[model samples]
Target: MHIHASLRFPRRLVDRRLLLSLSLAGFFVVHSTHAASFDCSKATTAIEHAICDNETLSQLDSTLNEKYQTAMANLSDEGASELRKNQRSWLKERDACNADAACLENLFNQRKSSLQATTQQAETQLDAIIASIPADPANAAYQLKQYRGPLASAWLVYLNRFEPTSGVTAEEAKQRHQVAVTALNKQNDFAASLLKDIENDPKTSKNVAVLTFLRMTIEQGRYDEVPPRPDVHCFVFSRQGDAAYRAFGALWGSSRDSQAPICPPQGNLFELPAWKQLNKILDPVMSAAYPNSGTIRYASYADWAILRLRATLSPTDFLKPIEGQSQESPEKRISEWDDKSWPKVQREQLLIAIDPARKATMEWLQTERKFTASDASKASTAIVNAWLNEQLDYLSENLSTGDQ
Candidate 1:
């Protein structure tokens, strides 16, 4: 699928300021005004030094200050004074992080998570900060590593707003979801403007996460296109919980007899690299150290949305064979080679069905996915190994989720 195709977006919910700020044909970009806790030019502590050195860090700092000031405004004089004192204390701890980008990032993480934006007042105060996406590059290169937490949280709230909640009528939930789909579609359309700009610029476009985020925005946008269901479905992307180790499904929280798995959309090598980049790892970094979940890696919206869309489409695809297609297991299919009585065409068909699937995977990786020769070879070898070992049962049972 060409994920880049443009779609119609609604204008109902978008802020007017954002509408006015967009400039496509103009020579000059209108930058959003934002400010930080302290002046950037003055010689400062390690954390301040890090913030001054990087535009993203500085942007985040500006946003953080904006959030803090808003937090203070809501409080009484005594509360505001106490928060001011707390801010100074926090600044001291933050300044202690001087020059360590990772340490400074941790501070932002802690600070942002600690602050809440519940009411309209907080949202209004913080609106400009969220709206202040720097032109062309929506996500700053490398700085996305620091942003994964906050952006993911924002995206989640957006989705969860549509999810069926306890006691909400199925009809009401569907109505809300229909509304959500429209809002999400518009959000992606707006983001696509910036994304398309990045894709045109060879220098910034190659940063895979930018592409990943863009694709994710587009995929999540399929809400409008998705067919509604009777029961509430919480799409499961990973093999976790009691059903952990199985393929995808709609893990029903209320147990309403949903048998099929929900498969999220899968990203190719181009987008996957950007995702891993944002998470600060070459591979999906498992959160072994975290006390609760076995693996702490947060699945990107693209990854999960693909799974959900896949699951939503052919829910029972894994359990049943297409009527005209061969249901023969890979082991049986391969064993037919030993049969002198086996028809030549049948043998070729079986070989064609399985071998091409594997080869296509490798070819796709090397060509379409733009994998490096070494990486393609390594990945292709793994597919060959799975075939050789007749582990194709797992693949067949799971609708040929490639190189899983």
Candidate 2:
């Protein structure tokens, strides 16, 4: 079943408390004073009244709003819209707290911390994008124009009068390119840190986590900005058998321009022992889940399984060319997901029935996929790793779709 992209899972109260404390750790450093993001005199709801009444809660509101505004300043129109939607969702949750000071504080702190991280990351990206451009006034001017986003508006305005034909020294551009590459490499290193969080609990990590990590790699190429290609090979290769190896490969594997010398020599990934083993595990489950063939088969959960796996499989797997496979190209395969008619009723029934085949898969996910085998043998470890990835795919298929 195709999952909705916006599904959110319930988080533990301890998670919220921990987040609140962490967010508040640096709170006083910037926000020692108290004020609400809005006018207290105009406070309407119980949630708003609570924030207006409590000094700490008012400060938290003001702090998050400040960070939110800054983040909005840096984002593209589309990004801003997404952030706004998320904030609205957060507001709904916050209002649900209704006069609970602790709940309001926790939610406010979490939002504040998230906004700060986003703004900082966007600032770093904008800086790198600026540095990546050739020092040639015209080239910079023209490239800056393409940005059109709020993040690049200042640079565009500053360089607006320059003619496209004007030139700068190649040596200067080379130095800037080197700096840009270094900045991007650092960004990748930061991404590695995020990957480490998932690696620490790969088996337990949610579908949202996996999908977010994969989405991060979607813009890896950015070749138009920096042609040298920032080296993410070390980032992925170092984490082999872990989530990073697979997540980082999603985009790099598909982009023809990304098959560069920066990575190890390529081989057909599907033929790899680990990949074949994963396929082996999935084959039966998918077959049992969707026994029918033809038109209905095209819309089966099995189809989504293939798409999700390809999306998360390591680039090393996709690096090698397929020999005698189905004639459908990758482009067509991606488009198929959106175009095919969804068999919602049959899918709903399948979810409700919980047949032996489905139960077995769930049992595997809950048990073996939770941790490596006790012996920790190389083969056992490989199988466990394969199972972990399969769990991620399974979670992606069902959890996000609310079919659980």
Candidate 3:
């Protein structure tokens, strides 16, 4: 994707042409006395003046022809044709390039805005942490306040030394610096609260717990420098209290069938039987992992469907579901030929498999002696991991069989 502009033009051709033209003019001016002293004013007519200028004009023309011949001699017929084709293609490409540049500019602007918003949110949360810090003499909060400034300063120094330049405007840099300052101030406040929590009631220290979570979250965020997968993080977090996660899971699950079927009948090869066999093995393992969640169930079902679809469909069709989902638009009813339909189908298939397991798991959790938020989160994480592992195993086994 990195483009070097210097490679586009032939510098040698330009250099040669410039040198040749100057040499020709210099030779005529130095060697020919009549050429150099041709008096246009005493010619008495425009045609005579023009005639007097012929020697200079002839030299210029000869130099140009030589340059042209040299350039042509170096080009193959195919290369010449390709060059012409590319020139024609460049007309369309120029507009596309401009549009792409505009899009990147907009994306950069949006990222700056998002960064500012995120920093503000973190600052607000940090302020709350500070306000919550108790003023007890033995409080960790008191000690934290004393050391927070130095820690924040050290962090800022590290960031300044190591972070890559973003090529942002001066105003943007100022805003980003302000955001960092705000974040640092908030961290100081949070540190004070952590100290207080430790001194008072260590068992129910929500502040300390949240701080630990945030530290882990920030560390993970740092690793995700490339085009991020924040959706996965959001989805995992939603299992705690976010209704949007459930909605997304439902939508994601429901859309699976609309994806291309794994085991569609094709010329001399029907993979339906093998797909069913694989599904039978996958079903129990998935059920154990995701006993009460439609999300995992749906995802597992889709995985199985993809395996079946791959057997009968071309590689292109196997890729179609992923491609179709990428188009962010309103969902439509499932149709036979519509690529978007596969996701819906896959989701439906997942729901059918997952709904029972989810109900059973919920019942089991309700009967447990200690059903706290932490316990629920742990359970969810365990289930998600198990489901992922089961699906991976099923896919691997089916792929090996299919290859054979």
Candidate 4:
């Protein structure tokens, strides 16, 4: 459910919708004395003449005229002038269809749909704004301002990209839901964290308002359920291609150098010095290729990166010498997502899907073979946060960044 910016539409669409909006609002007022949108006695064109002769069309024309007159009177002087100019121009073009009933009907429908009433336009604005909000807590306060408008009942409709998804069998849907549960749970936790941050703010009233509107949707049964999260769709290293490989290679100046086994990625990637640089390279490639990619991307990166690093430096360079339960071996950790199946070419990489939060399933895959709930929780947070910070920052830039 991508909501493209309405303002980005073509010029014709904007013009047609403007006419349609005015037409719908004023079309059926049923003014008998004023029976046409224009002066009937002066009508000359075949289409204009046809409208004056037909009772039904003459009624519709009068309705459009009523709306047009009211709108023009309320508009600013410049706006009224502009409308007058555009309408005159449009009438000329419209009349070219003459008495072609199909063309005339099509024209009416196009404008009507294009020009939603004031209320519908406002609701659409809310959806576009809410959907574009940053997933990070830092931007929550600024983004919450958009929730000020009345939340349209339609806004509550399910925003999930997965449900109503066709072609998947019941078992597959169940599995996908299972994988999504963790993410959904994580999203709920994140939302709670943001609410807490908002509460600590000096302006609690403003924050509460945003939450109230969101709750309205739930109560109205627009969304299927709370805890919004997407299903895990692929392995961490699942995405790779010549285009992706090119972006990866560009991380280093030369292709050969980028592919030449380098361990521990040249520098810190998620934060500080390398953060901005990494985002510049990763954002476009991710958007064009793996827009839906998630936690797996970061985890898989660690795997292959460590695999390459093992080529030169000792893998032990990566770990702490802590005892038993807490101790981490770089070799063992890398083995969690990789094995002999590692591909020579990234394009040929094999991907297997597994729920990252499912402790039992992950344990069976031998990832740290015996991760306790506490241990797994700590590991998941650390890895996921690293991934999320990069994601949030990238999203902040890539999403509709304008203040609309």
Candidate 5:
């Protein structure tokens, strides 16, 4: 959770030769007679200036195309076709780049509108540009039609990548809220299973508590740990146990209160009857498998692995009770609460589940082995891909079931 905030530019930008070439190309574009003769000063308004610049660039583009075509006249038909295909691909990338620039400009305008002092100035400039543009109905209609195809395609691509389209009906808005809900539920189920496993291991209760504490520390965005002791595995025990314990108390105490409605009211917070019953069943099995000090320290971890496996195989009905608690219906309890509160808890829980291993590995690599950014990055790809695949499988399965 404690992401390093080093400002890194693209590696391509850092290459001296690439930088020199870019500088020369930029200089050529800036000093070209066709580019310089645009007469931007002649236009009295922003919109007029923009239009004039675009028109001049279009002319320059046409001239360049004519020269390129003449130079390529000796090429065979197959060569010409291949060249055309490459040109078309380049054009597609250029158009997408320009569209992204326009989108950023729109976003800037929106942000400017949100401030009291800048709002009037931004609105005035926008209104002046709108008023200055001549509204030719025929041209406007044609441009509007031209815009729809790419806009629709872009929207579909975005929805498919980030949102969901699996169960959307024709009558519904393209936004798939059900898909999002189902995905979140699956993640929550996974986190809950991991938590249950840790809580259920009586023989390794101290180790489980320590791990839960370390995980909570990471979730709270803390990363101030001394290098692992020569004799100790940092993942199993940290020198800064006090910091870890404090983080655990804060995170889990708050979570227990938040989830109180879903569990039976009990006086002993750590000894919830449902969880205690599970501990009794799992403790003996764990003790038999891990009889030594070194392996016993990892008993909680093995318990978590088993829980993760069981979570994948368990029926959806196992989660139904909590599902009802999480329902978005306009019941008094939910309607009065802010929507963001519960999700923030869920995010914290998931982060806590995964953070101990990540932090320990990072600490080991950085403090012990002196890993470079590239080295750490190479190691992280496998970790990230495995997590992504697990989440994707959960999403695919739940979506297929129409679980929402």
Candidate 6:
């Protein structure tokens, strides 16, 4: 489907200054207007005292801090680390000019100019990289490695937000997440501005929204924070249709009868084209993953969504004829599926049903989901039971959901 043709986004006027101020608020680790970057009450060194004592120097320090943070935000991990190291080295040199306002001002100006230049260069490179991206919704996370700098690093955290950090206490994990949040917060202004621009551009808006929805779905499991607008629904349904549908029926969460597998909320995303796409990837999408409370399939969210959507749209596709049963009635198929006696032979039927797209799904599993050949070949049996339970549970719900 032509995503742009199907979706329309409402334009929003962004106040760049407000965004910048918000970014600044989030940028500083320590909130202080007097010293700007650090607290003056704890000022120890002569350099710190000198800056705190003089309003002009303090303002220069604050201005330089902004530029320094902006440069760090756009730089790669190695680049940001190097910048930090350089800043520390510069601090030592600046200390030598203790209480010398003229020297301090010169050094601050030069550092500010250098940071501005660095930020400009990094932004230029990042913008080119973003422009080159194809805006495709499938396998969005795979495109992440192509990014670099702190922005890239922040994305790394975002994409892998659910991954377990070995041997870390819960507190440690929380601390690490806070660190990641701090890093991403620095780019809030830039991200806000970019989103505003995307919302205003009709041609690229839906494509960008689809890409963003896919990425966020993989990252956060749901983009519920966004309003339930028509274009938003279009893009989300295009990528994670099944999950959206299941979510719409209120099938997820703690409800005991909620047979729908855990997925991102759909928010009125049911549409024919989106449902057809879900039908296309039904098996692997269904066989892909089973998310429980506080658990997710990670990058496989899209695949799972497709399967769930397909099941919702066409449950008959999941009902396979038993072996040696030459003529099966709809009653028999429903009875067997309901009895949970749906044979393992039905798995073979699924293979046949999905034969045409088996290769495509296999490649997606192996590449996008990093599934091994063996696992991908079987369309991932790790969650077959989850799929079965989902089928049984959701079928029992008596939902009248499908593309009508």
Model 5: clashing residue pairs?
Answer: none
Give me the displacement of residue 395 in model 6, in angstroms: 49
Task: Give the poorly placed runs of model 2, Cα more than 4 Å off.
Answer: 1-34, 135-151, 163-404
**Which residue ranges in model 1 land beyond 4 Å of their true spot?**
2-7, 10-63, 66-85, 88-404
lDDT of 1 by residue, 1-404 (tens): 00112221123323532555555324234533233557766736666667877766777787687667546533434455666787789878887885687788778767765654321243342332333223211332122212222232222222332222222344532444343334434544544444334335454323232323323332342222224221112222221211211212111111211222233334352234322332232112112212222111121222234332432232233233222123344444444433332334544444445444445545656675566666655554443333233223222222212222
Q: Which ten residues in a row have the lowest lDDT in candidate 6?
A: 1-10
Worst 10 residues of 3 by lDDT: 1-10
Would you give me the overall lDDT of model 3?
0.33
Across 247-282, the per-residue lDDT of candidate 5 in tens digits comes to 232122112222111111112311334334433433
Q: Report the alpha-carbon TM-score of model 1 versus the true structure.
A: 0.24
All-Cα superposition RMSD per candidate: 19.3, 19.3, 27.2, 21.8, 26.7, 18.4
lDDT of 6: 0.44
> CA lDDT of each candidate?
0.38, 0.44, 0.33, 0.35, 0.31, 0.44
- TM-score: which candidate is best? 6
Model 3: per-residue Cα lDDT over 1-404, one tens digit each = 00111111134444654686798899978766333123544766433344345554333323433333222222334433553464355435433433343443343344345333443343343333333322221232332222222222222222232222312234533443343345433434332333233324445233233323233223322223343322222211212222211111211222232221122322222223433443564454334434344333454454444322232222222222332122221112111212231243543454354434433333333344233544534443333233333454433233322111
User: TM-score for every candidate vs. truth?
Assistant: 0.24, 0.32, 0.19, 0.21, 0.15, 0.35
Report the lDDT tens digits of candidate 4 across residue range 238-313. 1211111111211211121222221243222223333244345434434643443343344334333432222112
Instruction: Quote the positional error of residue 104 for candidate 2 in Å.
Output: 0.7
Predictions ranked by TM-score, top down?
6, 2, 1, 4, 3, 5
Per-candidate clash tally:
15, 1, 30, 3, 0, 5
lDDT of 1 at 121: 41
Between prediction 1 and prediction 2, which has the larger TM-score? Answer: 2
Error of 6 at 160 (Å): 9.7
